[model samples]
Target chain A: MTLLTVENLTLEFDTDEGRITAVNNISFEVNSGEVLGIVGESGSGKSVTAKSVMQLNPSNSVYSSETKILLEVDGESVDVLALRGGKELRTVRGGSVSMIFQEPMASFAPAITIGAQMVEQLLLHKKISKAEAIKISIEMLDKVGISDADKRFKQYAFELSGGMRQRAMIAMALSTNPKLLIADEPTTALDVTIQAQVLDLMKDLVVEFNMGIIFITHDLGVIAQTADRVAVMYLGELVEQGSVRQVLKNPTHPYTQGLINALPKLDDLDAPLTPVPGDIPSPLERPPGCVFHTRCALAEPRCSESIPQMTNHGEGHSAACFVTAEKAEAL
Target chain B: MNKKPIISCRDLSVHFPIGGGLFERKQFVRAVNNVNLSIPQGSFFGLVGESGSGKTTLGRAFLRAVPITHGEINYSDGEKDYDLVDLPKKQLKEFRKRAQLIFQDPYAALSPRMTIRDIIAEPLEVMNLTSSREETDELVREMAHKCRLNLEHLRRFPHAFSGGQRQRISIARSLVSNPRFVVADESVAALDVSIQADVLNLLKSLQSELGSTYLFISHDLSVVAHICDMVAVMYLGQLIEVAPTRELFSAPRHPYTQALLSSIPNLDPDHQSDAQKLKGEIPSPTNPPSGCKFHTRCHYVVEHCKVVEPLLEHPESSHDVACHRWEELMNIKEIPVANLA
Candidate 1:
């Protein structure tokens, strides 16, 4: 079942220089019990799209009038963008959907204990007493693989290690039993060994909770290991979207292909890393037509002339490109 | 194999004194403990470890950035040889010109107040390498072009450039002095994946063009595997394993090295790795475990490992490992992969 649907979401920010579009008209859906990976580089607007789901964009952000963010909660659809600061927005923010960030330390309060923060969040969403909230928080902490939860509960966020702190953050996010979780680069700050442990924990939790997850990261390998379906973003545009296997094994978009080829593969040690030529254009200097044409190797004259619509190649595999989309259609 | 090493160290130990009081007992934090290694001329040697593993400290020790507690570091560029530990002040200035460092954070490394040309040419001015203003500008422009930076952007400040461009400026700044050896400490970690590849390629090409040995320090094993010819693993300020890149990746002897290699998230979803998952966090460096620093988390750890420290031994050519039961553990093959869910 589709838990959330974001349609024609366009966000622009009014900065000191001028008004700049951060997220172009991009759309995707997150279904329950599925992990949707949004992969992009800096300024790719992946984070902007994720924040838009929670209505967490800053005040200067200008959302397109046609933009629609529908959240299905208990079979009732709620338009997220229409919600103001009220009970409905609160319910949607932490009750039905919760978020975990890249820096666990920044999300957590330094002065407050981890258990206190988790208990407070739980009490805010659910009608429960302090005792019941503490009990559930302990259970969530243990579920995320933190040992000695009782003692760790009393300790402040700074007392826990980096990996443990991230786990605590996850536990706190999951304590509300959210239907959708937005994890933005949660494990990027962690070491590789700890990253493996966290990834395994998340996979296990997804099965146990049966909740949908929007995993946002730049690392293709992490997306390949966890995401059921993947979306590739480039300078505020959704360039490609498909199943993990299809997109990674046989990527159609030139931008997606460049991202995959740029990574240093563990299997092929001899292959030279081929980065997409040219740097990513700054957001202020938006390119005409396709945003990625400046760096794309297979860009044609038509690519610079007009924007390409998302052309479907096969079942659920779509790419926005002029050259490869036409070639796929020709086949 | 017979060629002399460009940079060699033996029994290197760098310790910093902590908390001093009139009546309180003095303590020390041994950042780099008895590390022994050699970087072959023109070889890209990699150092891999967690944050507290002292890989950065060891890299700094090569450039004499840190005080050497007790060790011998020999440096030779085939033109000059200097004992790095207690070099004279006059010779130290010359050594500074030959050895330079490329910092990890591009945002912090370059001065935002200065123009890109001034940032790259500052080293030349400080070293007094060039005679006139024209000579410095010519050298800076050449270095900037070599690093693939747009020559027209030299007049712009650092804030005008992006992360990858700033890193290019950082590279140009470090290379402008024409150093013999460069220490790149997590240089590409701050950039995006696509930009990281671009910087890595630039560094590789520059290595061949300049013939400068790089002591590449990073926590990413896959990156080290792709770029470095030889790699070393560090744990709790000690060298656990050192081997050729192919040999280390294919057959890691130390348990920690093995765990680190297996923990890398595989790019293929269908491939399920049965490699042992390391448990617990890296122990606090101030109070590291005795005997083997990694024994606290090693799966195959024995009672003997807790009592006796193991020295790095060359079990075969070009591979050194510091583990007591490596020979016995080598006999047991890795477990076959189970069905993927």
Candidate 2:
């Protein structure tokens, strides 16, 4: 069953001066046992789009009327945006969908013990007693490979190392058995060795729990390791998306191609890094038509005159570029 | 690869004191264990390790930013020679002009109040190398031009610039003094991937143009593999491995280095090789393990490895390894973990 489906997710924020379109009109779906990666640099609006599914964006965010976030839990569908501050929203926020951040220290409360925080989260999400919640939390902790978890559970977040803190965060996030886990730069702060361990654990848990994951990051290497499908975002617009094999091996969009080229590969160290031509434009100075025309080498005059919709390249591979899209259709 | 080294260190170590009251026993965190290193002139020497591996502290010790616990660091640029440890006060101030540092976070390293021109010119003023304000401005302009900063934006504050541009401003500041050796501590780690390439290319080109040695300290292997000519792997405050970049990457000797290389997520999905996955966390630097600090996480452990710590020994051509069984384990493909049992 489909875990979540987002349609035409157009979001805007009201600043003091004016409004900025944080997320352009986009649509995607998450199915159980699949990982969808959203890749982009800063100002690319990847995080903003992920936050929209949970309605976790700030108060000033304005969603388009056509925007729809349909979340399904146990064969029952609910509109996530329509859910006001109540039990339904709570169920969706922590019960069905859970979020783990990059920095584990900031997420955990300073004064409370890790065990207490996990217990509170479990009790709030499920209809269980405190003792039952504690039991479940400890089991989750042990499952995340935290040795002597019971003793560590009583300690504060500061006592744990960086890698250990990240594991504890993952444990807390999974205690409720969430249907979808949104991991935003989860391993960006970890060392390579620790990241490998965590990545392996996450892959295993996805299979064991049989849940969907929306992994958001800027690293293509990580996306290749974890994601089944890839969505390449450039300045609030999703330029291309497809299966991991298609998008990475034969990327149709120029921005996605540039990103892959810029990444230094261990196997081939002689190739020089080719940075994308220009800086990501600030939202205030956003371009007129195709957002990436200023930096895109293949952009034409028509690219600056009108917007291009996604042109299909078969097998769910699509790109929103006049040049590449036309080429794909011609081929 | 055989050029005479510009900087050499022997018995280098940096240990910081932990909390200690009157009744409590004094303890220390041995950040950089006694290690020897030689950096060739005009080479991008990469120092790699995880957090608490003391790469940062080692870099600072070279610049004399941090007080060394015990060591002798000799610096020579074919013009002047200065001993970092026993230098006089006047010579130490003079040594500042010969060495400089670049910080990790470009956002914090640059001042928000100062304009781009002033930020770059501040180093010249502090060093008192220039005679007049016009000379400083000219030097700043020249360096900024090389760093690809727009001259018109020189009046703008750091907040007005993007992350890439802010990094450029800091680079211009560091290079304006014409230092012989520069330690860029995770300089491009905080930037976006697209911008990181630009900064790295700039660093590479500028290194060639200025003819200066660089200690590029980073935890990222891929980045170091591309730019560095030589690489050193640090573990638990010790230099476990050091070799030419190609030699180290192609055939790493140390077990820890092998695990580190294998841990990087290969971009090719089909290239996933579970060669050796490290087991536990790095032991605390304070109460380090008795024999070998990495023995706890090493896959191929033995009773001998648990009793005697191995010194850095060169068992092959130009490759240094700190493992006792490297030579014996070289010909064998796999030493079964069951051997430990």
Instruction: Give the number of the best model, judged by lDDT.
Output: 1
lDDT (tens digit, per residue) of candidate 2 on B204-308 = 999999999999999999999999999999998999999999878887888898888888887877666575888878889998887777899987789888889
Clashing residue pairs, candidate 2? none
Worst 10 residues of 1 chain B by lDDT: B332-341
The TM-score of the first chain in every model comes to 0.99, 0.98
Give the DockQ-based CAPRI class for model 1: medium
**C-alpha TM-scores of all predictions:** 0.97, 0.98
* Off by more than 4 A, model 1: B20-26, B335-341
For model 2, the superposed segments whose C-alpha errors exceed 4 Å read B334-341
Assess the local accuracy of residue A293 in candidate 2 as a C-alpha lDDT between 0 and 100: 92
Candidate 1 TM-score versus the reference:
0.97
Candidate 1 chain A — worst ten consecutive residues by lDDT sum? A84-93
Candidate 2 DockQ vs. native: 0.53
